[model samples]
Target: MERIQEALAKARAQRQQGSATRTEHAAPPKINPSVDDAWGALSPFKLNRALLKSHRVVAAETGRDAAPYDLLRTKIIHQAQMNNWRRVAIVSPDMGAGKSTTVANLAFSFERQRDMRVLCIDLDLRRPSLHKVLGQKSDHSMSDVLNGHVRFSEHGLRLGERVAFGLNNGPAPNPSELLLSQAARDTLEGIEQDYAPNLTLFDISPLNASDDNIAFLQNVDCAIIIAAAETTPIKRIDQAERQVAELTNVMGIVLNKCRYISDNDGYDYY
Candidate 1:
């Protein structure tokens, strides 16, 4: 115990000295930048590394032709190019299916892998959770934009070096009614214009034939439906695919929260 105490004291003294030296040499602190501003200002190098690891894990489990995120990124960009689509919507069969998680990761992957300016707009409205998933505040949401209460440039939430996201905590009056408003159209248009050649992902509600997903689909370039493992039935997946088909171009389906084993038979993913 005496030896341990001495070692601890020495370590603490060294740390304090180092910290003092650093502080003395450190430059003055800069202004606290807004979320979107910070995102746009920072480069995507560091975030890309984290995304690469995620892709490797996913690819390993799916047995897909390409690397995990690389495969998805390539597919998404290809779809965008083929259809001249800039907006992508990530939806699910229902709530609690990891759609927001997938959207956040996908946005990160796109920015990291494709080197494109990516923005994810959470239009879930009724049940907004993208902020929680991304560890961001939900005070400012897409609801503000849809209601013409806030400007897009002001409310966009930055997620990383170059990724920004927006949230909507259900628009005024009724979300369904707001979905059809001209303000919604203008907001989408503004985003497309400002983030030119950028990829935008809309995290929207489930499609139950005549739900908001149908209307939301009209604004995006393509849509990806998320289905939870075991929780989502093939019938619903089929229905989702079919419903998205009613639109011009549909991206595909994401099997969310999948479990996988490594080639060495080790478990992963916490």
Candidate 2:
């Protein structure tokens, strides 16, 4: 009986030690909340103005014959044609390439122009600038959700009657890690289930600067590569196309900031 008690005591001790070890090893995940930095970067009217300008450029170049804003609406409807792909990643070759502006306007156009349910996720963890483009004050972001600092619903903001997803900036770990995390996948799945939108746009980081964009590409059904007019070299566009093709289901390219001199602008859309 004494030997039996000793064996049971030893087993209890082992269990206690295991519990202690687990408790000691487990720590709450850390996150960086760059809310002030994100909100401080914008004025309310700045994004609206940019959207208006881009819309005008597209309208004039395409010979849409409608108001620029109306033309923008038409373009967004065209973007949602990807099969089983509610999420679309918008990317560019490099910075100052007008991707953020294009994505914000595209999201806006999706909601206002088509009356479709849309969620615009700003997955550009490195140098995230979507908040400024959307004129939203994001208290929590994608980073927060990934690390358990917040929930996905908590980080979402509604701007101009459309949904915008933002992520907080923190110590720059490999941004791809977060994008490929299970949390991101589940969050996207929830988005697909809850809204079941005609389109969901993910404004990802520039491909040349970071690989974060690639992490979400395979998960999303398609990608849209943006090229600026007169500036984006052919090689750069090719590289963007190749990169997206390698990682994602490539939809096609959208030539932004193109001149209105050509008659083939609108008709070229396939």
Candidate 3:
């Protein structure tokens, strides 16, 4: 527990530094009134409430199960809006840490905000579980879109007027190389320019899995590391936090799947 607290403190210090740097050089964002129109053009799909609940995406629910994620959504939005951060990557120390579920719930939570536009992308090309979690199978591969072979509009899907998703059906070949390439950066830039989402959440590979997350972290403005309680080791969380802080702003660490929270402790649920 001491190690975890240390990691959190380091992350907070890194976030403060990143915020200062961005504030020093950040320019005012351009107002794009057509952003809503762009989002509206995407094909809309209905969310399966039952399927989402089964997959642990309960942020859309009005119950206590949704409280933690709603608070997470609020914190993320506050930090992003304050620091002019638009791209955020969600990663974990290792697989099975609930990274994908967190991304989906955040998307749903962001969707409830009528004025916020969100783009959820599955950048975990090695496994790509986000699509399954969202209960939507994509006909298009996100890797193809990143490689410039397909346009985002052709490969993306929308929910209502605010949320868009870029999902993948299968794993990509040489995902690390692809993420490190110039094409991937260009593709992301184009997407942000065209879609104009208030926030873009990337469900990327775990930190200890491979170089894929490290390669792709350069493209995002900030990241949050999700660690599973009673499962993820404190040393792993510390290492992952350090790696992310070196690459981008460390927003904070999320302790997921906790089973032992006191009745009075609501803020530490996630």
Candidate 4:
């Protein structure tokens, strides 16, 4: 909490200093929010296209998977516009439901859209995977930011022009406390104000596995439940749906790892 307070104060002081100095200093070369800062300074490493393809990251080059991500993007945009939502939590009923992969693909897909800003944060404190998924390994992440180890700007990884990611790698002893703390909420709000991303994707832990998703969803706009094709049981899905609905808007369910069958009628998703 003290770290968050100091960050807030530092931000305020910087703003005040900027206003006072004005024409004399010429704003000390502002950090361009539009593009990657430099090589290895503030910008994150560029995602390897080949590695991403192997991981089944949905991109424009991906023939079959692109359509689903495109449709998902459309639906997400429509819902966001309809409900005036800017933040969404991507969660699953249990582990191995492809929640992290879904978030990675969605963020990558959003990058292709013109004028769309997306900030993808790995809030799965128990097992932070975005760093590895995005190929942007970082020593610091949202855990550090929330704990006041670093500020958002200093720790954020800018991938493309429109996409920025805050990733975590280490597990905190008290994961729920980090997400539910006032400092966590304020840190998110600060990042929102600084970056002003159109869509903020919070990749959270499984809803049934722990109370992290429910508690964290209280700080976001909506949630999308991810269910594996055959592994996820109906009762677990129903339970997760009901529980999430009570906390935030159940945006929609993503059926990941679904098989596709092709016949004379072309392709049919089962």
Candidate 5:
């Protein structure tokens, strides 16, 4: 813990010293109605319970399977509220670490909060899969919105009144360049300005995969690294942690797909 803290402090110091002035842009075009009104206007979609269950998006269930995600939601909300962070990136050291699963569950968990408005954007352009995990398809992908081919209002889908998703239909070409472009920044800023979600979760590519995650990390206020318990190495986690801390605040690490459960951990009642 101490080592992690030290690394975070060092990285933050470096970030502060090297931070560059942000490019100024003209005021973004606003939606006709207010932010809340625009959010309410999003197209609603019905979720398939069985499909969600098969994908292990247990946070939508009423059973004990949802408990862990609820706890994660509480912790994330607390930390984000404390720090005034709205945009959060969910990243991993490599592919197949359940980062997309975590993003889905976490978004559903936030849905349980009546007052919370959440936006989940699938930014994993090279291998987009969040839509499949959620069992939904979109006519316009996030890439289209980022490239100004489609407006977010036209592309985003609403799940209930509280959650909205910016999904991808297929793999996008030249993902890194797209993510780092000024158009990307402008589009993201416009979404935040118009949607005004309490939390905007971006499911990005793995840290070790390419420069895509690095390019997009600059737009987020903080990030959470997801690691597969037995598959993700400690060194990779450390390296990813250091890299994220250098770019933005490190909320914490989440360990997924663990098989062992201690008897004394106190969930037997469930």
Candidate 6:
């Protein structure tokens, strides 16, 4: 914790010492919408080294294959900065479309930004995998927070002080109902108010799989739709876009899992 604090302090100092023009893209003043006492209690825990490797997520480092994530991250950040969008949801047209993987990788990619703070909340209740993807394990989950059993910030896994996560744990029989409830909205708002992250990402269930994704989308500022190459149906993608467009801005689409044979330079996202 001490080390992380020092690193953050040093980074901030460097940011402050930069040329005067650096503040040109400064974030908008806060409205302080969700501030609460729970914000101060979030714990810091180290991610599992082996687990990160298995998921191909390295928070601070950008490898060749992760290049696409870096590109996506830059574009999203530019848009978020321009629009003052703090919360963004990642969803796909259907299951097995690699939305979870895209969300996880994007979170890590955003975490790499020295001046940015990111929070990733896994809302894919029926098939929660963000915690596993981040190689995190905990007694507290989003369910506990929603059930009023725990504070929203109490059990987060940290990637330095800048990156934190509130992951879903067990399947909920009534996932859509839970997401639409005021309790769920309050929990997410509480986390945002507390952490004051530059970006908040919700890893949601596939659009056609259940009502969960659509319900969750209502709370976020914008969304990204990830489509699997050759695997996802065009009709479903169109339907998902129509649904999300009515709720929030469709930031852009990410095409994943296309056949990429290794070449002289590196692998391509295509």
What TM-scores do the predictions have? Answer: 0.70, 0.67, 0.86, 0.81, 0.87, 0.80
Predicted structure 2: lDDT: 0.59
Which model is ahead, 1 or 6, in terms of lDDT? 6
Instruction: Please give, for residues 1-270, the per-residue lDDT of candidate 2 as tens digits.
Output: 454334334434443444433232222212223433332232222245455444432321223433343564465456544243455788898877777777755654554543455667777888887666554555666777666667655565554443444545433356777776777767666544443445667888887775566565656656888888788899999988976776655777877766464475543321
Q: What is the lDDT of candidate 5?
A: 0.82
* Cα-based lDDT at residue 136, candidate 1: 51
TM-score for predicted model 5 compared with the true structure: 0.87
Flag regions of model 5 displaced more than 4 Å. 1-33, 262-270
**Candidate 1 vs candidate 3: which has greater lDDT?**
3
Q: Model 3, stretches more than 4 Å misplaced?
A: 1-33, 265-270
TM-score of 4: 0.81
Assess candidate 1 and give its lDDT: 0.62
- Give candidate 1 misplaced runs (Cα > 4 Å): 1-67, 169-173, 262-270
**Model 4 misplaced stretches (Cα beyond 4 Å):** 1-42, 60-62, 262-270
lDDT by residue (tens digit), candidate 4, 132-208 = 76666676768899888798788887766777888886776688778777788778866765666677889999876
Over 113-212, each residue of candidate 5 has an lDDT whose tens digit, in order, gives 8877788999999999999999998887899999999999998889887889999999998998898788998888878778867788999999877778
lDDT of 3 by residue, 1-270 (tens): 454345445545554555654343233435476765677778776679999888888886765788888889999988988878887899999999999999989888887887777889999999999989988877788999998889998888997777899999999999988987878877887788788777889999987777787677756788999999999999999989888887788999999999656677654354
Better of 4 and 5 by lDDT: 5
Candidate 6, residues 16-71, lDDT tens digits: the string is 45323223223442434343233335676565667776775643356776777888
lDDT for each of the candidates? Answer: 0.62, 0.59, 0.82, 0.73, 0.82, 0.72
Separate clash counts for every candidate = 2, 1, 0, 0, 0, 0
- The runs of at least 3 residues in candidate 6 whose Cα sits more than 4 Å from the true structure, single-residue gaps closed, are 1-41, 58-60, 260-267
Give per-residue lDDT, candidate 2, residue 262. 44
